[model samples]
Target: MNSRRTALVVMAAMLGSAALADWARPTIKVSDSFKNFKLDAVFPKSFGDWRVDENLPVIVPPPDQQAQLDKIYNQTLARTYVNREGARVMLSVAYGGDQSDGLTVHVPDVCYVSQGFRMGETRDATLQVSGDIVIPVRHLMMTMGPRLEVVTYWVLMGDEATTSNTQRKWVSIRYGLKRQIPEGMLIRVSSINPEMDKAIPLHKDFINQLMLAMPENQRDRVIGRVSVKKDDSRS
Candidate 1:
């Protein structure tokens, strides 16, 4: 009996030691690397026909809402852009160093619902900024009383853009398994237009033109470079 009990204790100690070793593994901290880059500089102030609106009233969330957002995000940027045609687009970007499940950036769907807006149709979309570059985005329609708006947004987990909560969580887990923590950013653009057909295409054009004006490195962070794999069997 004494020998059996000793063996059991030894096995438990070995398992605990293995668990500790796993937890102590080194991780590539992407957030620290991003600290040197400025998001404000990443996006240009004026691009093509669109220019930043200086007179537009700044959007301020209610105190409670602002408090909640402050807890999740480390940095945020909000701006309004107006084109020569009098079209205006509201842009919001929020970044968080810790992209874990608890500290992840909230999507427009959740934010709208919290602010008493009814969510309409939502679908995944691909934005082709150029012939060779494609970025995944989420398209959503939100309405509250007479106010209706169309929104296009995406979330970046490290270098990958993900449109769904499940995808975001999966990416987080993949990094965690690799013993790394990934930073995340939410990029959202919205316009007050009831015509979904016209609004969507305009939004896409705005995104494409804006991307063209950004630096190559900055653009990649927003829309990742696609890797084409050659078929091994063909060779």
Candidate 2:
């Protein structure tokens, strides 16, 4: 009789938690904020010394995995760019209109792992995108036999940057309490380089230039708040 009573109590607690969660979830859609977020419109093909590679096309994932990506993301961009020196970088971006708890952007590590690549420990870093504009980014590497891919990436929940699940949850709670829903996206760049030291900085250079290429409003949408301190000294 005691065992059955304990089981009933546990079930009751679960049911109560579910009801509370449903009640706390935000319903108000902040879609207007991201209505102008078109992947093609923002990302440029030729930026800095880089130009799209006509010969080396971007790789599309397996049909099954791609189908899953299609369901989650409203838009995605994958392109390869080669510099004047012949160095190439691969850029991928995924954005969604409503990135609710169940429909968040998939991390690149998981995507690469599913494609049979061995992933390294992801390290957090910051990318200085021109003057006074710095954004948090992540660095990692993927390996498959002889091929090594060094990657730098970041995730955004609306204007708030959330790099991990914990951060995402906190952002979600903050939005939920305010009765607002936020969009989400994954911005990634990678290169096939044997040297991690060299490859990492190249990715940063690529990102910095790309962000610089974007117009103010378009760039602001991805980088969130642009709170730059004004120069009090007279020019």
Candidate 3:
């Protein structure tokens, strides 16, 4: 599906579901499992070949748009980093303690289109977190006027990656049944590149490098694999 179709499908699913809005209230809190969960402190500013570039500018939402974001997100972080080769990537993250919005609406697919950017179809993809751990993700190709940007993103819910709205809703309902409220973190990586082939691998490497630098539990918050490993160990 194209961006418009994808956006409409999600919006329809959201607006049509009265049950979701009512039942989606978080009952129990599910911690991110990190001692002190601070996005700025948790994620490294300089990792591997990439380092924070003070001169680079990342996309900033208008004041009105930021107001809406503030309501949903407890904390938000935005930064631009440059690899040694001079390539730059933008990272945007939003964390909410009770992200039981039925299906998360704060995604690039939804918000980018709303912001006048022409997003292409959002495709399902995978990112190899380590030697064995792989996580599902969504890739977006967007443009506004003469600029082209490629994005890779995923949402974390209860140590699981929820890339689709249906997946997000299912995660919420499952946790709600247990009287648990799942925390949510939307991690997005974007770069200005016309060639997606080149952009995606760069994103994967950048994320893998960054995650490897973090502790296992802290890393799983972004990639979602804490319980999975524990379950594997039990076997």
Candidate 4:
């Protein structure tokens, strides 16, 4: 009788422990999962032949002057993406206007933040229309946290040259929460079909909430780059 009672007690204890483990959800340390990104470009060469026309007032801005513009434009891009309710984010801008004509800039797509486990993401969306561009793996690795290997894919679009610019990215990042994120929860941080201003709202709310939950100091650490729309309202 004593032996039977002891075995039953041991089995019950094992079952209880398993149940407790099941109830715990996987979680990521706020410090590790957070980061920001930034990128920008400036034009120094005169569009000598590409100039709009002699009659046109197109003239290359002095290097120093261009540098000043860089400072301002880069800051604007950062403010648009990173300074949100206190979240580390990335900002990127590419500009090259002919004095007489306009310049076409390609903006890399902003990847979506997934549930934090499993496959990061795999799809394409319309960001801007700038014809065709490449994402490249090396760049993708930089944005994704150091924990996972980088993956690449190609994205193509037509007509919407501006939207195409930011829609294509080359890297996919995977991360975890319970210290062991199940393969099922992971998602990609990129764009989807039907490029339109309205698309921004879908996941923006969730990301903002995540940022709000993080500590203030962590929020201040701006890390990555962002794509800026000349018309802030459209972005």
Candidate 5:
């Protein structure tokens, strides 16, 4: 029986090594790269009725945590915006040149959990930016003691936007099979509000206005290609 167990362990080890070898093999080639785009320039300073709040305190991970994040992401931007109505929103975007099987963008759920915030309800949502231009997103509420926040985020895998981690993995594998390594970005927008019902609509309005203000060419980085059919009447 011991000898049989030893043989089984050996087989398992061999299988693990084979899988590691496959993942390490350079079978993927990056046909198109997003490395050249500047993330800072992609987002505007003032958009619609909102303006940048230079005095607003932006929360970021400490040096040790940030060091770890730096290894995963090539670039990151964090900013706060406020409108004349006294509403405020925080935006964060992280981009990586290689979003292959082993390396990928980190989602807010993981980050918030790591930061000691209790993750609340999470669901997939679609944001109608304009006439028939809907973008997929993940919405969740997070709380730490009495402080509550509503977060809306999305991951851009190449030109496709998805909220499912499974879908992101499939996209990476599909591109890997085609010998193409895809780049990806994670965009997160959040606001402090205990009332999720009202907070969500405000978040959507902020996104819509922000997207409208962004340059046409750079908008895809924040919100991936709109796949919904166009409403000619609205256009």
Candidate 6:
């Protein structure tokens, strides 16, 4: 979708005050580009005989829109991720404050924080509003279950809300990451296990394709890159 319209829809999604259905779009300041050249430039590495969809969408919510997201996230929406072999890779939101930050929201039994990406260890980077969100390249990598040394672009859009006490609140959000993985990194979209020919459909098409395209012998090696646990201090 066009940037302007996407910004409007995001604004409407916010506005938790429930005071009005009408939403005033939040002001936006997009970063020039957070794509780390130091990382993206070092491409053509062992994609491990895999391929990643260049068209996959990678848009996340801004840190300033957290307050509004509380209600939606608190809902019963299932946590989603791709399962590689026996490992369960998840996309989760980690933050400080009370358990309310994660636990209070009540996650699905199947969902979990991606391994090696500890939410607690990430530095608290201040967002546009009063709070902060995690901003670590490794963290994004874990969330996607792929070892990527690619640049990332972060776009933030927030909806402003004022309480009866005249206090303002915001919700920081991340749709997901966007990066150009090595040319041939396979992702699981849909497949059947050879042992039993059991049907397996990973929620994400890119992940599914990557899983099937890569040979079994290389799966362990390719997935290994994401297995390393970067120190939380650096996360």
TM-scores of all candidate predictions against the true structure: 0.87, 0.83, 0.82, 0.20, 0.82, 0.18
- TM match of model 2 to true structure: 0.83
Q: Candidate 4 residues 38-103, lDDT tens each?
A: 222211111111111123232344677557555423222221222233322222223221111111
Candidate order by decreasing lDDT: 3, 1, 5, 2, 4, 6
Residue 227 alpha-carbon offset, candidate 5, angstroms: 3.1
* Stretches > 4 Å off in candidate 2: 1-24, 102-105, 226-235
lDDT of 2 by residue, 1-235 (tens): 9999999999999999999888877887676655676889899989898889989867887899889998888898999998999989999988876776723447876778878999975677666665766666678888999998988887877676556877777777777797778777788889998777789878877877888899988787677663343323211
Q: How many clashing pairs per prediction, in order?
A: 0, 0, 1, 42, 0, 33
Number of the predicted model whose lDDT against the real structure is largest: 3
Better of 4 and 5 by lDDT: 5
lDDT (CA) per prediction: 0.80, 0.78, 0.82, 0.28, 0.79, 0.25
- Which TM-score value belongs to model 5? 0.82
Q: lDDT by residue for model 6 over 29-123, one digit each (tens)? A: 22212222221222221232333333334334445444544543321111223333432222222211111122222221112241232222111
**Candidate 1 lDDT by residue in tens digits, 85-125:** 99999888887777776234478978888889999988776
Choose 1 or 6, whichever is better by lDDT.
1
Instruction: At residue 15, give the lDDT of candidate 2.
Output: 100
Candidate 1 clash pair list: none
For model 2, state the Cα shift of residue 70 in Å. 1.5
Error of 3 at 32 (Å): 8.7
- Over 136-172, each residue of candidate 5 has an lDDT whose tens digit, in order, gives 7788999999999999998888667878778788878
TM-score of 4: 0.20
